[model samples]
Target chain A: AQTVTQSQPEMSVQEAETVTLSCTYDTSESDYYLFWYKQPPSRQMILVIRQEAYKQQNATENRFSVNFQKAAKSFSLKISDSQLGDAAMYFCAYRSRGNDMRFGAGTRLTVKP
Target chain B: DAMVIQNPRYQVTQFGKPVTLSCSQTLNHNVMYWYQQKSSQAPKLLFHYYDKDFNNEADTPDNFQSRRPNTSFCFLDIRSPGLGDAAMYLCATRAGPQETQYFGPGTRLLVL
Candidate 1:
């Protein structure tokens, strides 16, 4: 079974600054995928970024990027130029070479003015 | 527009009462999943359907049941609503097991 853990329960970042949310997982599978999802006050889950384990290069999406450390079982999200819209609960999830996706506890991000 | 849709965004039910939540998808995905999430907690998988075949999580309680009658529709039926069941129910779909899952805006259930 794969388990994901996000140590930070809550995080705050000043608007326009950068913030990183840490996540680590334990999985025996060699091939897998990692993802970051955001849920706002509307309670809608939105995909932020995704990384494939086979790829050594990290994944970057506009203002969001991931530091995917396959060997260390770490995948963290970095939000650059954080905005109010970035204030939401961020979840780190893992999908093994097989398909069942499991999620971490999540970190509630707050962007301060 | 949201590719996945969950109807009755907010529901109010009495204890032991039966409640049903519906999900519809336009993404033409072959897999659909149901998840339960309480306050400040990770979403827990309840069950999922790959086409018409249903797969329930081993730890899922008997109080929760699911059905997918066709390609685009699925339902979550809670036979006996308890206070513990009062939480957001999320529906997700993917083209296949390895594809990214697209989520619908969750339905919030309130048990009284």
Candidate 2:
């Protein structure tokens, strides 16, 4: 079974600064996808960014990006220019082709003004 | 807006009582999923429906059941609620097997 692990339980970043949340996974499948999801206090889950295992270039979406290292089974999320709205519980998820998705325990991100 | 919607944002049920959570989607996606998330935990897959085909996770308890009457609606029925069953239930929908899933705001379930 594939599993995702987020080592940090909680993280804090100053306004306009950057923060990186670490994530690692255990998967034998060569073809898979990694995703970062944000769940705010409202309890609504929102997609942050995604990275395909076959892609060497890291995926970037505005201030959110991922450092996906397939060999190391590491997929970290980086939030640049962090804002108050970024405060939420961030989850790292994994999904193999034609399979169910799994998520990490989650990292609570706090943005400080 | 083509989004997933869950009814009764919050619910309180007594122990041994049965409860049902409803989910509807405007996206008209082919797949709908139900996930249970305990406090301070990740969401766990309960079951999913691909059109009319029901798929339950291997470890899901038999006490949990689901119904998808049509393309737009799905329901999660817990036969007997327990304190341990109290959690946030989330609903998600996707266009295809490997498509990105859009999640609903979730319903907070409290078993007393």
Candidate 3:
């Protein structure tokens, strides 16, 4: 079974600064996908970014990016120019082709102004 | 906008009572998923429907059941509610096996 781990339970960053949330996973499948999802107080889960294992280049979307190291089984999310709206519960997820997705415990991100 | 919709943003049910949560999608996707999320925890998959084919997780409790009568609507049924069953129930949809899923706001279930 594939499992995702987010070591940090909570994280805080000053406004306009950058924050990185660490994630690791255990998967034997050679091909898979990694994703970061944000759940705000409204409880709406939003996709942040995604990285394919076969892609060497990291995926970047607006201010959100991922540092994906397939060999190390690490996929970290980086939020640049953090804003108050970024405060939410961030989850790291793993999914293989034609399989159910696995999610981490999640990290609560607090952006302080 | 094409999106997933879950009815009753909040629900309060008594112990031993049965409850049903409904999910509808405007996206007309081929897949729909139900997840249970407790406080400070990750959302756990309860089951999913690929069109009319139901797929339940191995660890999912027998108390939980799902029904997908058609392509656009799915329902989650808890035969008997327990305090432990209280959590946020989320619905999501995907176009295909490897497509990005769009999530609903979720229905918060409170068992008393």
Q: What are the per-residue Cα lDDT tens digits for candidate 2 across B1-112?
A: 6399999899999998999999999999989999999877899999998889999999988889999999999999999988999999999998986688889999999999
Tens digits of lDDT, candidate 2, A1-113 = 89999999999999999999999999999988899999998669999998889899999999999898889999999999999999999999999987889999999999999
True contacts kept of each: 0.88, 0.80, 0.88
Which residue window of length 10 is worst by lDDT in model 1 chain A? A93-102
Higher-lDDT candidate among 1 and 3? 1
Which 10 successive residues of model 3 chain A have the least lDDT summed? A41-50
Question: Residue by residue across B42-82, what tens digits does model 3's lDDT show?
Answer: 99999998888889999999999999988889999999999
* lDDT by residue for model 1 (B22-80), tens: 99999999999999999888899999998998899999999999989899999999999
lDDT of each: 0.94, 0.93, 0.93
Per-structure clash totals for the candidates: 0, 0, 0
Clashing pairs in 3: none
Off by over 4 Å in 3: none
Candidate 1 clash figure, as a count: 0
Tell the DockQ for candidate 1.
Answer: 0.81
Summarize candidate 3's per-residue lDDT along A28-112 as a digit string, tens digits: 9998889999999866999999888999999999999999999999999999999999999999999898988899999999999
Q: Model 1, residue B12: displacement in angstroms? A: 0.6
The sequence of per-residue lDDT tens digits that candidate 1 reaches over residues A1-113 is: 78999999999999999999999999898888999999997679999999989999999999999999888999999999999999999999999754689999999999999
Looking at model 3 chain B, report the run of 10 residues with the lowest lDDT sum.
B93-102
